[model samples]
Structures are given as structure tokens and as C-alpha cells.
Target: MKGKYVEAKERLRGSIAPLVTPFKRNYEIDLDKQRELIEFQITNGTHGISVTGTSGEPSSLTVDERITVMENAVKTIDGRVPFVPGTGSVNQAETLHLTKVAQEMGADAAMVIVPYYNKPNQQALYNHFKTVADSVDLPIIVYNIPGRTGVNLEVNTLARLVEDCPNIIGVKESNKDFEHVNRVLLYCGRDFLLYSGIELLCYPMLAIGGAGSISATANVEPKKVAEMHNAWESGNLEKAQNLHFELMKLNDVLFKDTNPAPVKAALGMMGKIEPVLRPPMGLPSKEVLKEIHQTLIEYGKDVQNTFDM
Candidate 1:
């Protein structure tokens, strides 16, 4: 198990795109488009693929929908790159079941978010994560997005979880608190695979020993996002920095509204998906949409001619 984990750790680092779950106009899971999206990521040089994550809108999906997405993601990925599915749900039983399903489907790792809405205390959080980790042999990457989750996984809590669960290997820090993340690496040790979930922090995180980003921007700019990491890894710091600066506008614009809305709109403009989001999470307004479209043009996405497609 240790040897297997060592191999996973090595392969799991890079631009792991947390894919937007493409939906049909009727809001059904478009499995065909899902497969296409995976293929697009692979062909465009995304280092890894994750499904049913924040960008994939797992909260909006039924348990069966999430599992179906994972199953398809596993088959479509087909060992080309590491597959990390967001298996954590607000419900403990559901988190366990989805994580176990991910394990059964041969996922390289499972990304479980800190439980949201209920806002459990740190001890409860630790207990929840430890239970999931113990239940599966799959490596776990804890997702910490306090903005969305309504609770912070304190540095001590993360440290404790790491000490207790050998399979809990990393964290995707969507936090904006720069000092907090620094302390995480400081206390948790540099070997911890810290990934930046915040778009603007992707390059900065790499500078601070982050594994890579599970960035939403990668949904639109897979090649460049992957190149940023590849450049950094290959000792081309200047190229990496340049790409970071170049990607800044698109990164900022995508989050101007909510997540996958802007992302789906951008992809739709590029003729990737239908830009359909499930109800209650609708498309961005015309103003935000215009800004997104303009930004994509500035970033050379060739979306000008494809918006209506």
C-alpha cells in the first residue's frame, strides 16, 4: 500500500481540471458531452482529471448522478492520468458510499470537500475525514474552501487528520488567506501535497511547494494551464510566470459571477458545452457574459465566431 501510494503521489501533481458537468438543455447529465469534455482535457494536455467537484456542481447532483459521472469519468480517463473524484457530501454515509464507489472504479485519489451548510466543528471534521480515509485504500485530497463550505479546517485539525490517516495525502486549499496556507505547509511539513483551488493563487501556490491547481480556469485554457505547471517543473520559471500573468484576466473574469456559470458560458462560447446549468444556478447575466466573452477574446480563445454555436 505504501509503494502504491508513493506512485500515486508522484503522478497526482499538476493541473488537475475539476471539470464542469456538462448538461443537456433539459438539465440531464450529458454523458456523451461528459466523455467529450474528458477527451478535450486529455488532448489539450491537462495533467489530470477530476469530476463531480465544485466546478462539476456536485451539490446540485443526486447521489446516483454523481456516481454515474464518476463511473464515466473513470472509463473515459482509462489510466491516461490520475482521476480524483469529489466524493465528499454533507452526509457522512453518502461521502463514504461515493468514496467507496470511486475506489471500486479505480480512482487514483478521492477529493473530499469539508462538509458545508452544517458547519461541523474541527473535531467533528477530523472524525468525518478519518472515517472516510479508513474506509477506503484510495489516497484522499481534502478540499478546503471556507467560502463555500462555511467552515475552516484549522491548521491543527488538518495536521491531526494527516497524522491519523496515512491515506489522507493532500489538500486543495481554495482559501485566500495566504498566511494560513503558508502555515499549513510550515506545520504539516513540506512533503504535504498542497494544491491551490483559488484561480489567482495557482502560480503562487506552486512557488510555495503546492502540488498543482485543481483550477476552474483550466476548463477553458487546458493547454496553457498545464503548460504553466510543466514550465515550472522544467525549470522555466520565467515562462511559468509569464503564463500566470497572461492568464490573470480570464481567471478573474470567470469568477465575477459564480463558478461553472461563467465557466459554462465561456465553454459554450467556445462551442464546448451547451452552457446549460441546472436550475437555481443559472447563466451569468448579459453584462457578466459580455465581460467573459471579451476576456476570452483577449486571451485568444477564438470564441468570437463560436458564441451562438
Candidate 2:
């Protein structure tokens, strides 16, 4: 229907990450820590970082802080790996504003999630995604996680949007429904990138010709995830399976809390960054802290001074 959002999308059929935002004990955006995390991911072999994603906790950030985080990440990356920003707002107008900001700041693309609370139907979902895609020249990857959004993106609705909105390049499906993933892949063909939004299920998704993943676990073990993907791609199924177990265990830890809580704590334990969180999402409890430390130590990771149960 228009020029090619497809071209930009081709570069991203590989592994990407939904980065964990680093915060200080004082609850400020630690730019240095953010830089380290991006560099760590890129250096450890991640393809890209989906900044400000649900995993990145956009709800905890202000409008200006979100923009600041985007600008900071763009500056730190300096044109190495591609960048994706989750600019979804509860309101359509606010979402558009953030999407434009992302495009203007030179981000490669934007991921707008389904409108929460309002719980739009298929037509509204189509229009919502198409509207954002039409608003920006950059490619758009719609996020469909009904568990978080409270509204599933039906296959027909996604099909309609991909047919009508050329700029809608792909989706991050966290629904954990293989039937839905199957439908999207079958109808959308190899032209669209379908990333498994579920980290533990990445190998199965890739087995089905799906694209890569956008994982929170990658925040801590980028190399582990990359190695797992590389092994699977190289036909080393056994190695991939073993690596998958490692990721699954770690992901179990991450999801133990609301999110970012366990992961952020793990980062702190490794002495990679401080473990701090905004309100409503605070530092892990002593019980959670004990489990996190014990798990890390069990995984043979360092759990010295930075982390205590």
C-alpha cells in the first residue's frame, strides 16, 4: 500500500531484547547503568533492545522521563543495534504523541500495545494500530498480550491490519496461545516478523519459523539467550534445549514478582547495577530477596556484597 516498512523489518528477524531499566536506590534513572545495560546486551550479542516496553515499566515513568529515556538510549546506542520503543498510552492521542517522538528521535520503529482498560474490539484494534502506523513513517510492531492489555488481538483483526496497513510490520505475541501464533504465521507468511513475546517459549516459536524474541531474561543473560538461539539455528537441538532450561529457570525467577523486581534484584546481586524500583513496584521483600540470591548462587553466579537475603 506504501513504500517499504518491510525493508527495515528484515534487519530484525533476529534476536531482540526488551531491556530492564536500571534505577538508583534513590529511584532516579541511572544513565550510566542504562548505558552499561545496552552495551552489555549489544556486546553480549543481542540484536536490539525494545526500550520502554512493559518489561521496561513504562507505567512507572513520566512523559518527560519516557522521552528522556528514549533520547538517552538513542544516544548510548549511537546507531549500532536497532531500537524499538513502546509508546502505548491508555489514550490514543498520547500514544500518537509518543510514537511521533520516537520517529523524530531516530528510533528504528515503534511498538504500540493494545489499548488497556477500554478493551477495544477487533475493529478498534485494527484502527488503533493502523492509526499509529499511519501517523509515523517508521515501521510499527503491535504488541498483543491480552493478559496485560485485557483484550486479545484476534487473528482476523491482525490479518486485516497487516493487509491494510503496510507499515504494520510485525507483532510481539505474549498470549502463550500456539493456535493464535500458528494462525498468524500461516496467514502472514514469511513477510512479517512474529516474535515470541514469551521468553521460555522462544525455541518452539523459532521451530515454527517464527522470528526471534523480545525477552526480559535477556537483560541479565544476553549471551545465554543468544547462544541458545545460535545453537538452535546451527542444528544443535540438544544444546538449545539445555540452554532453554537455563532460560526457563531464570525466567521463572523474573516472573516470580510483578516483574523487574526479580530481574532488577538479580542485576544488583551480580553487582551489575543497583536494585531500586519506583512506587507500586518496590524492592523485593526479604523472602523474595532470599530466593533470588539462593537461585543466583545455585546458578553459579556471584551473590556477594551487592545482594543479601
Candidate 3:
């Protein structure tokens, strides 16, 4: 039962990109531009990329776009990097459909968030994840972000799912709870991978044996995030800590508003893509964008200092 879990954990143990969806001026999917972003992340050293996550503005995308992106991601990467697609929906039926689509699209795994809006109870949450895990042949990474989802994936529920749903391998622990994260790791022992979903908590999560990050920041600065993961692998504790702290401020800036807005703005500042987030997610406010530009450059300044060392 734990064999697949172990393999999936290893598959995710690196700087996985929570990829940003590039849109045209009129706000349509730009497949060619998205391909370029994939090439950029891969060439610069990102280990994996996950589509339809919060950073990808999941809610902003239509189901058709989600399918298209999933297909495009696998086809664009063409096996150069690992792929994980988000398969969470308020209903289990939709979740199953997406998970099956992800498997069909050749994703290595699917990141399933707890049911949002409806706020399911503990048992309901367990069933939702277990049903998906059992339905799909691909591995699953539980995405626990109470902040966005309005519910939590409690430790007990997680432990039970891992025990029962063999393919439910690990979690993108988003609450920044090292204590809870460590407990899950210890409970499942070697069977579970603890993926840091919060960019600011990457180092601390790694300190407690977290495998790596499903990081939003990695979309903008793939090289730096990869280097920090490499430093951790090499046992260079000080370097990893300094790099983590250095990026924390920028992380706050990006999340200050609804996700992907500030990050898309920063990427625009870096000239990676347009700052256009779809209507409901509209552009970050002028003042927020100004602060984002300043904070991110500060992160860049720190990166330069580290390189100059």
C-alpha cells in the first residue's frame, strides 16, 4: 500500500512550480506564451510544475481551459519535467472527472484540495479524498489550505486517508504548521511526503524533513528557489535559511491580496508576462502594485548579495 506512496513522495521532492497561466490582452489563454513559460522554468532548473492551483488562478479558469492547460502542460514539457494538476472541486463527481482527465493528460499526480464553500465535516472530507484516490490510478497530493478553502484537512482525517487511500501519498501543507506537518510525516513514516505550499515556510518545513515546495514564488524566480532546495539537499543549512528569510517579505506581498494578482504583477515587472488577472481577480491596486515592485526588488537585491558572496 505504501509502495506507490513512497514513489510519489520521491517524484515531488524538489522545487515544483505553481505555474501562472499567461493570458492574452483580451484575457484568453495563450498556449504559445504558456509554452515559453514552461521552457523558461525547465531550462532554469524547476523540477516540476502544477497547473490549476491557486497561483494559477484556478477559480478564474473555465473547465475547458483547465483541460486545455493540463493537456498543454504535458505536451509542452514533453517529459522534461514532472507534472501535477489540481483536481479539487466542491463535488466529488467533478473531482473524479478532473483526476481522470489529469491521468489521461499524463500528469504524474493530482493535487486535491479539501471541499470548499460547502465546508464538509471530517468524515465527508475523508470520503471526498478517498473517493478520488480510489477512482484515479495516479497518485494524489492532499492540498490543505484552510485560508482559501474555508475548511481544514485535520491531522486525524489525513492520517486515516493515508492509511486507507493508498494512493493519497502526501500533502501540500499550506497552513505553515510545522508541528502538524511533522506529525503527519512521523505518523505515516516514510510513506508520506510533506510539500510546503506556503512559499515563506519552505525553509522551516525543509528543516523538519519536508520534501520540497509546491511554491508560487518559484514561477517568478525558479533559479533561486531551486538553489535553496539544492542547498538543503547539500546540507548547507545557513544558506537555505538566509535565502528563505530573504524571500519571506516578497511572499507576504504576493499573498496580501488574492493570489496570482501580486505575483502576476511582479512577473510583469520582471517582464515575464502581463499583469492581467481575469476580471474577478482584477489587477492589484496601484499602491499594492507599487509595494510589490519594491518588495520583490528587495528580494532580488538579497539574491544579488548572496551571489556576490
Considering lDDT, where higher is better, how would the candidates rank from best to worst?
1, 2, 3
| 1-309: candidate 2 lDDT, tens digit per residue | 455565676677667888777888888889899998899898999988788888788888988888888999999899898899889988888899999999999988898888887898888888888888888888888899899889999988898888887888888998788989989988876668898888877888888887788878888778888888788878899998898887787778777887778888888888888887788887778887788787778778877544545
Candidate lDDT (C-alpha), each: 0.92, 0.84, 0.82
Model 3 residue 12 CA deviation (Å) reads 1.6
* Tens-digit per-residue lDDT, 195-233, candidate 3: 898887888888777889988988777888988998999
> Who wins the lDDT comparison?
1
What would the TM-scores of all predictions be? 0.97, 0.94, 0.93
**Each candidate structure's count of clashing pairs:** 0, 0, 0
Rank order (by TM-score, best first): 1, 2, 3
C-alpha root-mean-square deviation, each candidate: 1.4, 1.7, 4.3
Off by over 4 Å in 3: 2-5, 299-309
Pairs that collide in candidate 1 are none
Best by TM-score, which number? Answer: 1
| Clashes by residue pair, model 2 | none
